[model samples]
Target: MSCSIKRTSSTSYRSGGGVCGGGSGRNSSVSCRQYASSVIGGGSYGGGACSIGYGGGMSAGSLAGGFGGGLGGGFGGGLGGGFGGGFAGGFGAGGDILLSGNEKVTMQNLNDRLAAYLDKVRRLEEENAQLEHHIREWYRKQAPSVSKDYTSYYQTIEQLQNQIISATVDNNRLLLDIDNSKMTADDFRMKYENELVIRQTVEADISGLRNLLDDLTRTRSSLESELESLKDELIALKRNHEEEMRQLQSQTGGDVSVEVNAAPGEDLTKTLNDLRNEYEQIIEKNRREVEQWYEVKIEEVNRQVTSSSQDIQTSSHQLTELRREMQNLEIELQAQLSTKNSLENSLAETESRYGCLLQQIQGQINSINSEEEWLASIRCEMESQNQEYKMLLGIKTRLEQEIAQYRALLQ
Candidate 1:
C-alpha cells in the first residue's frame, strides 16, 4: 500500500514521494517540503510553499523445514523448522522537512531545488530579455513609419495650391480686363449717342435750309408774273395812242390847215418810245438780279445737303464697325470665361482624385500596423508554448534521474 499528501504554506514550496519494497512485511512514511519558482517563457508564476508525504507497507513469509532443506541449511532450531515459525516482518518510518531545517540534508535538498528553480528562472529571464530586445528592434524599424508618407502628397497639394493661386490671379486679371472692356464699350456708346445727336441737329438744319429755298422759289415765280402784266399794259397804251393820231388826220381831210401848238405837245411818239424802253430796261435788270440770287442760294443749299449726307453715311458706317468689334470682343471674353471655368472644374476633379488616393494610402498603413501587432502577439504566444514545453521536459528528466538514483541505491 502507498499513501501521499500535499500542502502549501508561506512563501516556499516542498514536494517529495518515496516508493518502498520489502522481502518481508514492511511499512515506511516520509515527509518533504520545498520552495520552487515556475516560469513560462517571458512570464513568472510567483508562489512559495508546498508539502508532500508518502508511505508504504508490505507482507513477507518464511519457508518450512522441508522447503528450507533446499536452502542447504538444516533446520537449526525447532521454531525454524516449523511451517508457521519462520515468519518475519519489518516497519520503517522516515520524515523529510524539505525547507524546514537548517540541517545539512534539508539544506542540500533545498539548495538543489532552489538551483533547479533558479536555472529555470535564469532561462526565462534570458528569454524575456531576448523578447524585449526584439521588441525594441521592431520599434526601431517601425518608428519612422509612424509618420505618414506625405512627401509626394505634399508636393501634389503644394502644386495644387499654387495652381489655385495662379488661377485666382488670372481670374482677377480677367475681371479687370473685362471691366476695362466694359468701360471702353460704354465710352463708345456714349460717343455714338453724341454723334447721333449731332446728326439729328444737322438734319434739322438741312430741313430748314430746304424750306427757305422753297420760299425763295415761290417769290421769284410771283415777280415774273407781275413783270409780264406790266409789259402787256405798256403795249396796250402804245396801240391806243397810234389809233388816236390816225383819227385826227382823217378828220382834217385833204385840206392843208396849219395850226401852231405849244412845243408840239412835246413829241408824243418820242415820249411813248422813251417810256417803253425805260420800263423794259428796269424789268430786265430786275429779272437778271433775281435769277442770279436764286441760283446762288440754290447752289449753297445743294452743297450743304451733299456734305450732310456724306457725314451721316460716314457716322453710320463707324457705328456699324464699332458694334461689330464690340460683339467680337464680347465673344472672345465669353470663350475665355468658359476656359477658366473648365480649368477650375479640372482642378476640383484633381483634388478629389488625390484625396481619394490619400485615403486609400492611409487605410493601407492602418492595415499594415494591425498586421504587425497581430504578428507580435502570435510570436509571444509561440514563445510561451515553447517555454512550457521546455519546463515539462525538464520535470520529466528530473523524475527519471531520481528513479535511476533510487534503483542504484537499492542495488
Candidate 2:
C-alpha cells in the first residue's frame, strides 16, 4: 500500500497524527472546505492548530479536542490539511509507505476501523455545523435586552416633572404673597409710627396749654392781691381824715372869736372845711375808678380763663379720641402681624412638607435606577448562563453521538 493525494469537491481534510505547534509544520496555515450543506466553515483557514488537526479528512472532528460548532470550524481545516501536508515523518510508521505485506491485513482492519470512526466524526461534524448554524441564526436574530419597555416609567417621570414645575410655580407665588404681606406690614408699621409721632406732638401741645393755664391762674391771683392792697390804703386814709376832723372840732368849741388885721382872718375854719371836702371828693373818685378798673380786669381775666378752659377741654377730647384711634391702629397692626406670622409659619411648614416629599421622590428615583441596574445585571447573567447551557448541550449531544457511533463501530 502507498499514500496518494486526492482532491475531493465536497470536503478536504489534512492527514496526520501530530498535535498543533509540536511538529515541523509549526507555522503552517491550513484550510478545509465542506461544501455539503450551508457552506459554513467552507474554504476557511486557521493558524497553528490546523497544521496537525486537519489531515486530508484523516483526523476526525475530535482532532481539535471536540467540535465546538463554528467556534471550532478551524478544526475541520486542521483535520483536512494538518496531517496530509505536514505529518508524514512525525507520525512514525503510520504512513502507508511503511506498511509490510503482512501488515496489510492489519492496516486494512485499522483502515476499516478508522473509516467507522471517520463516519462518526463526520456525523458529529454535520450536527456541530447545524448547531453552529442554528446558533448563529439565533445570535443574529435574538435581541440582547436588559429590561422590558419603560414607557410607563417615562410617563411617570414626565408626571413628576410636571409636578416639580407646578411646585416651583407655587413656591414663587407663595414668595410673592409673602412679599406682599411683608410690604403691607411695613406700610402699617410706618403709619403707626407716624401716628405715634403725631400723638406725641399733640401730647406736648396739651402739656404746654396746661402750663399756660397755670400762668393765667397765677396772674389772676396777683391782680387780686393788688386790688386788696389798694382797698387797705383807702381805709387807712379815711380813718386819718376822721381823726383830724375830731381834733379840729374839739379845739374850736372852747375858743373866743378874735379879729386879726388884714381882711378879718378870711374864715380859717371854712377854708379848712372846703379843703376837706375837696380831698374827700377826690378820694371817692379815685376809689370808684380803682373799683371799676379792678372789676373790668377781673371780668376780662374770667373770660380768658373760660375760653382757655374750653379750648383745653376740646383739646383733651381730641387727644382722647386720638389715643383711641392709636390703640385701634395698634390692635389692627398686631392682628395683621399675627396673620403674617401665621402665613409665614404655614409657608415654612409647606416647604418642609414638600421638601420631604421631594426627598422621597428622589429616593424612589434612585431606587428605581438601582433596581434597573440590578435587573440589567441579572439579565446579562441569565443570558450568559443560557449561552453556556446551549453550548454545553450541543457538546454533550455531539459527544454522546460520537460515543454511540464508536461503540457500534467496535461491535
Candidate 3:
C-alpha cells in the first residue's frame, strides 16, 4: 500500500508498506517507508525519510536523509548531514528492540525522539532568531554615524584659495610696477647722461668764449698803446717846429737884408700850425674810432660771457636737481624692490603652507573614503549573513513541521 499527501504549496509526503520475502527464503518480511518534501524561499528541501523492515520476528531499520536547499546549496547539505547522522545513530540503536515484537513501544520511542528533535529544532530556531536580533543590534551600533561635517573645511579652503589668488594678482601687479619703475629709472638715467653731455658742451663753449675774450682784451690794450705813441710823436714834431721858427726870427732880427729874386717864402709858423692842427684832428678822430670799436667789442664779449655764465649756472643747478631726484628715485626703487621680494617670499611661504594643508586634507578625505568603503563591505557581508540565517530559519521551520507530521503518523 502507498499513501501520498500533498500541500497547497510545494510540499508533499509519501508513505508505502509492502510484504516481501526475506533474505532467508523461509521467512516473510514487512517494510514501511516514508518520504517527505518541502519548498521554502524558492528552494526545495528533500525531507527526511524513514524505513523499517521486519523478517522472521527480527526487525532492522535505517534512517538516511538530507536537506537539499540553501541560498547557494551547501549550508543545508551540511546541516542535513549532521541531522541525518544523529537520526541514523538513534535508529541503529533502536533497531534491536524491534525484534521483541512491540511495535507500539517502538512507535512510542520514535515519537519521543521526534519530540526531542522538535524541541532541539525549536531551541535552534530561537537561537537563530536571537542571533539575528544581535546581528541587527550590531549593525545598528557599528554602522558609521552621520559623516563628519566638512563644510567648515570647504569654506576654509575656499577662503585660502581666494587669498592665494588675490596674493598672486597683487604680486603680479607689484612686479609690473617694479618693472615700470626700472624702465623709468633707465629713461631718467639716459636723460641725465644726455643732459651731462650737453652741459659739458656748454662748458667747452664757455671756455672758448673766454679765450676769445682774452684775445680781444689784449688787442684793445695794444691799440691803446699805439694811440699813446702817436700822440707823443705829434708833440715832439710840434716842439721841433717851434725851435726852427725861433731860429728864423733870430736871423731876421740881426738887421741883415738879402736880395732874392724868389717869391716871398710861405710863412713857416702858419704852415707849421696848419700841419699840427690837421695832424691833431686826424689823431683825435682815430682815437675816438678806436675807443668806440673797443667799447663795442668789449660790450659784445661781456654780454656773451655773462649769458654763457648764466647758462652754465642754470645747467649746473638743473644737474644738481636731477642728481638729487635720481637718488630719490633709486632709493624709492630699492624700497619697492625690497617690498616686492618680501611679498614674494611671503607668497611662497603661504603657498607652501597651503599646499601642505591641502595635501593633508586630501589624505584625510582619502582615509574617509576608504573607511566608507570598508563599512559598505561590512554591511554587504552582514546582509549576506542575515540572508543565510533567514534561509536556515526557514529550513528549521520546515523541518519542525515535518517532525510534527511524523509524530502524528507514529501516534
Candidate 4:
C-alpha cells in the first residue's frame, strides 16, 4: 500500500492515498479524497472516503494547525498498517487478521476526536441559531416608523402664498386710490381758494358803491335847502312892487294936468310884471332839471347794488356746497386708509404664522430623513450578518459529512 499528501501555502490541500490491489484473498480497497480552499483568516474544507480509507483536511488559522496534522499522521499510520496486512495476505483469508492492537488504538483515538468535533459542530449550530434570533430581535426593535404625510401642509402653504399675492395686489390698488383721492382733494382746495378770492373782490366793490350812494344823498339834501330860500325871496319882491303901484295911484287922484309928449310915456308897471313872470319861470325850470338828474342817479345806483348783492349770495351758496362735498371726500378717504392698514397687518401676521409652520415641517422632514438613513445602515448590517451565518452553516455541513464518512470507514 502507498499514500500521498499535498499542501500549499495558499491553504489548498489535496490527498490521494491508500490504494491497494490484491488477488486470491478477500480483496479490500480504500480510497480517500480531500479538497480545501482557504484565505488568510477563514476557509472551507471537504473530504470523502470509499471502502476503508480515512481522510481529513483543514485550512486557514487555528483550524489548519490544530486538526490538519493530527488527522493526517493518525490516519496515515493507521491505514498504512491495516492495508499492509491486507496486501501481504492472500485473498482467501478472513478479514479478522487485518488490524493489530496499535491500529485498534489509533482507530479508537480517531473515533474519540470525531465525536468531539461533532459536539463542537452542534454547539456552533446552536450559537448560530441564537445569533439569528438576536438579529431578528434587533430588526424588530430598530425598524423605522412610517413617515407622516405632508401633502396637506404643502397645499396650505400654496394657498397662503396665493393669498399673500392677492393681498399685495389689493394693497397696491388701495395706495393708488388714495393717491387719486388726494389729487382730487387738492383740486377742490384750489377751486375753493379761487372762489374765495372772487367773493372778496365782489365785497370790496359793494363797499365802494355804498360810499358813492351816501355822497349822492348828501348832495340832494343841500339842493333842496337852496330851492326853498330862492322861493321866499321871489315872494317878497312881488309884494314890494304891489305897494309901489298903490302909492302912485293915490298921489295921482285929483291933479289932472297937461299934455305929456316924450315918446308916448313908457309903461313901467307892464315891464315890472313881465320881469316877475320871467323870474318865476326860470326858478321852476331849474328845480325840475335838478329833480330829474337826482332821480336818474339814484335809480342807476340802486340797480348796481341789487346786481352785486345777488352775485354775492350765489357765490356763498356755491362755496357752501363745495365745502360739504370736500368734507365727505375726506371722510371716505380716512375710512379707506383704515381698511388698508388693517389688511396690511393681517397679511404680515399670516406670513409670520406660516413661516413658523414651514420651519416646523422642515424639521420634521429632516428627522424622518435621518431615521431613514439609520434604517438603511441597520439593514446593511443585518445583511452582512446573514452572509456570515450562511458561510458558517456551509462549514458545519461539510464537517458533518466528513464525520459521517469517518464513521462508515470505522465500521
All models, RMSD in angstroms: 17.9, 13.2, 13.2, 14.4
Reference-based TM-score of each model: 0.48, 0.47, 0.60, 0.53
Candidate 3 TM-score versus the reference: 0.60
TM-score, candidate number 2: 0.47
Question: Per-residue lDDT tens digits of candidate 2, residues 1-411?
Answer: 011334333233333422211212222222322122112222222222222222321233332222222122222222222223221111211112222353345335434544554454456457756766676576556534454565775676677667667766766776676677667667666766766676676667657755765665676577557656656765676576677767877876765986677664476557766876776687677667766766776676667667666766766676676667667766766776676677667667766766786687678779778876875775686576566445444534444454344344323
lDDT of 4 by residue, 284-328 (tens): 888889889888988998888889889888988988988898899
Candidate ranking under lDDT, highest first, comes to 3, 4, 1, 2
lDDT of each: 0.51, 0.49, 0.61, 0.58
* Cα lDDT of model 1 by residue, 258-352, tens digit: 88874745775577678768877876787688778777877877787788778767877876787787688778768777876786687678668
Model 3, 1-411: lDDT tens per residue? 111322111222221221111121111111122222222222232322232111111122333241111121100110121121112211221111112234345456555555554565567667767866887788779766676999988998999999999999999999999999999999999989999999999989998998999899889879978987897888788788778888888877866788989888888788888988999999999999999999999999999999999999999999999999999999999999899999999999999999999999999999999978987887797687666555545544555555554444333
Q: Pick the candidate with the highest lDDT.
A: 3
- Which parts of model 3 have CA positions greater than 4 angstroms off? 1-145, 235-261, 390-411
Measured with C-alpha atoms, the lDDT of residue 300 in candidate 2 is: 66
CA lDDT for candidate 1:
0.51
Residue 125 of model 2 has an lDDT of 57
Query: For this target, which candidate reaches the highest TM-score against the unseen true structure?
Result: 3
Score candidate 4 by lDDT: 0.58
Candidates 1 and 3, the one with greater lDDT:
3
